[model samples]
Target: MHPALVEEFKSVDAVIASDARTAGVDAFALSLLKVERQARRFVTYLVFQYPCFGRSDVPALRKTLSDSKKVYFEGILRGFDALYPQPLEALIGAEYAHLKARVDEAELHRNKLFHGQLTEESLSRAQLLEFVVDMRRWCELLCDAGQQELGYAGFGSSSFTKSPELTMSASFRIQMQGLADYDAFIKTVLRRPQGQQAQ
Candidate 1:
């Protein structure tokens, strides 16, 4: 999985566990919210890790990130399609729709959970933990896909710090060649969350 995603996952996991222990059922709603928040952050991190712009576009990207206003999951998905549509498609092929649907379902649950509309029919501590597990598995699937399809090593791999090179498909490599410092950026990205070990 992407290091940033993993970092956010572990951070939220610890908080949710602590809250569940102390607040019990009261924490279920807020815990799910936190999970949703972290899920959005993870999606953002995953999207941005790919090079989707030319050399002159870094400033625009930086400004976008610098703006503190929130961009919801839908907006993030649109921006990704507008910028780096092909990489994701090539990385996951026909499964893109399934991935989007999964995210959509999560977002729906988040909305219902937030509005306090979810009760015994749809919300519970076990369900919340199950959602967390599902997300973790989703991240792992994406990581595995990227490792195989793009040659980007996943976290905990022996070669995690290595840059994607000849191992990547030629077509994909050509697509990314136009982006400046892509290799260097990827090397750094792959080696991230260095000293912060997951508990």
Candidate 2:
């Protein structure tokens, strides 16, 4: 819902679509969709639990999972390249580089938080809140990116739809309860005063 998040979603959508079109395959679009979905599931878990944990603590966990996902996706791309070596070769190279950079950034953040001895006081609550918002926005952007890529892959306007099947996955549904728990925790935290003494 944040303006910055909205802008980021738009940017990711553009990138995904552009990348897919460049690769010229439905498989790439599908794989990106799966990656986006998984990322969303992880982020939603983090955001929902933001209140109970410190910012420094969450980044390490997130970074670890993100790094794993990046590796999985890269391998998937390589497999796709092996199957369709010509049209997708060049596109895979560029996309792999971009994805690797993102994974590296995530690792850097994780290291800063877990290994570099950062403290929660180093970042204000508002800043941390913004980070949560950004993470959610990134998930949305990744989804949009998949859609855009599908379009570029020549899926046609008819492929675009708002069906439950398109918008929701079983994995997403299974994680919804966990996300709800996280949201409840955040609400409880927000209701309390920042410096009020605990009973």
Query: How do the residues 88-191 of candidate 1 rate in per-residue lDDT, one tens digit apiece?
Result: 44555566676556555666766665577664365556665555555555555656665564444233332212234433223332234323443333333322
In terms of lDDT, model 2 sits at: 0.36
Candidate 1 residue runs with Cα over 4 Å from true position: 1-8, 19-59, 65-71, 78-100, 115-120, 151-199
In candidate 2, stretches whose alpha carbon ends up further than 4 angstroms from where it belongs are: 1-107, 119-121, 151-199
Query: What is the overall TM-score of model 1 with all chains considered together?
Result: 0.47
Give the alpha-carbon lDDT of every model.
0.45, 0.36
Cα distance off (Å), candidate 1, residue 188: 30
- Steric collisions counted per model: 0, 3
Model 2: weakest 10-residue lDDT segment is 151-160
Q: What is the C-alpha RMSD of each candidate to the true structure, in Å?
A: 10.6, 17.8
